[model samples]
Target: MSMEGFSKVFEMYEAFRELSLSRHSIREFRDTKVPQDMVDKILELAATAPYASGKKNWDIKVIDDTQTIQAIADSIEAYTTALAPKIREDFREGFIEYSQSFIAFKDAPLLLIPTFKVNYSLSLMVEDEAIKAWERDNYVKSIATLSMIIHQGAHALGLGSCYMTGAVIAQEQIKKIIKIKPRHDIAAIIPIGFKKER
Candidate 1:
């Protein structure tokens, strides 16, 4: 087809409005299974996400095993349950209540934990100490941008997902289970599954 003809035919795919509008932060999940192939396809789309210097020095730990998921979820709950009381009184009760469901990693069939190496080579290369903060911010932004890609990618594949940062709250304990070294920057724990039909 000609350029104009193609453009007219593909007008609906031009804008990302429908994708954006359809995606939501899903909390509840059905007992439906999300096969490894579908997860791999979504990861493939997520891998195409761009980063600084093409340095894709990020780890995407896919936890599908039920036992490991429960362990990680337990650690998250242990940490959050204790920490929730220290939060501002106005939000504490709600926060604790939410953690019951929020920290339950095993409930979802797929868990994607995205972490970036906490390498400061860029900061160290710069002579000015103040430049370190800029490097740090950029590193975080790089991984965060990739997380957005993964979230949208999952949605596109008819999978519901939640960006669960509770995993980071107990990063120390969860790292032992996930075998990740401490201090590696964990962006968020994403739980993917079919949304429970209401």
Candidate 2:
């Protein structure tokens, strides 16, 4: 292979390795605030990620208000507390740990909530049968594609993020507090900022 070809291959490998090693669930963040422009750029890049059937199911909400952040954290706590005994114990410990590791969204200066919009109706008919089943399958496929695309974009931006399913458990309350529409389902919550060294 020519020198140019070898250089391209090496560069690709290096980029891949860098993202693999650097992409981690970050629970700690520096006290500094992330620039709004940088956050917007990352979100724009994430939106460009491929989707199934050309449908974009992911909707992101960037929360920066301290009051709203506290509301979200409170809702998350309440939802987690109400889970079945066995499951609660298993997750409560980790939730507490995560809470301590990262400051509440208020303290962190940035919070990102990604939601998946469900796009199926029972009224549709396919060959005389209701199209609900097919619609659900397609919705799931689209959400999966959105997730991969968003996370990959985040990794490429040199910003560390942790996918919080805990936030999803309190989806309804979060939606109310964040003012997201009822049709949009929360998928993950990411609080992005500079990483804090252990």
Evaluate all candidate structures by whole-model CA lDDT and list the values in order.
0.79, 0.67
Q: For candidate 1, give the lDDT.
A: 0.79
- Tens digits of per-residue lDDT, candidate 1, 1-198, equal 899989886875754668888889887788877988888988888888777645677878888877888888888878887897789999998988877765855688778888887567766776877777776666667777778888888888888898777667777788778865446777788989988899
Error of 1 at 12 (Å): 5.6
As for model 1, its CA RMSD to the true structure in angstroms is: 2.9
Lowest-scoring 10 consecutive residues by lDDT in candidate 2? Answer: 99-108
Provide the lDDT at 82 for model 1. Answer: 84
* Top candidate by TM-score: 1
1-198: candidate 2 lDDT, tens digit per residue:
999999999999998788777677766677777778778777777777676545676677888776777788887766655653446667767766664432344345578877666665443544434466566556655655555555566667766666666566667777778877568777667777777777
Q: Residue 185 CA error for candidate 1 (Å)?
A: 2.8
Model 1 residue 58 lDDT score: 81
| Per-model root-mean-square deviation over C-alphas | 2.9, 4.3
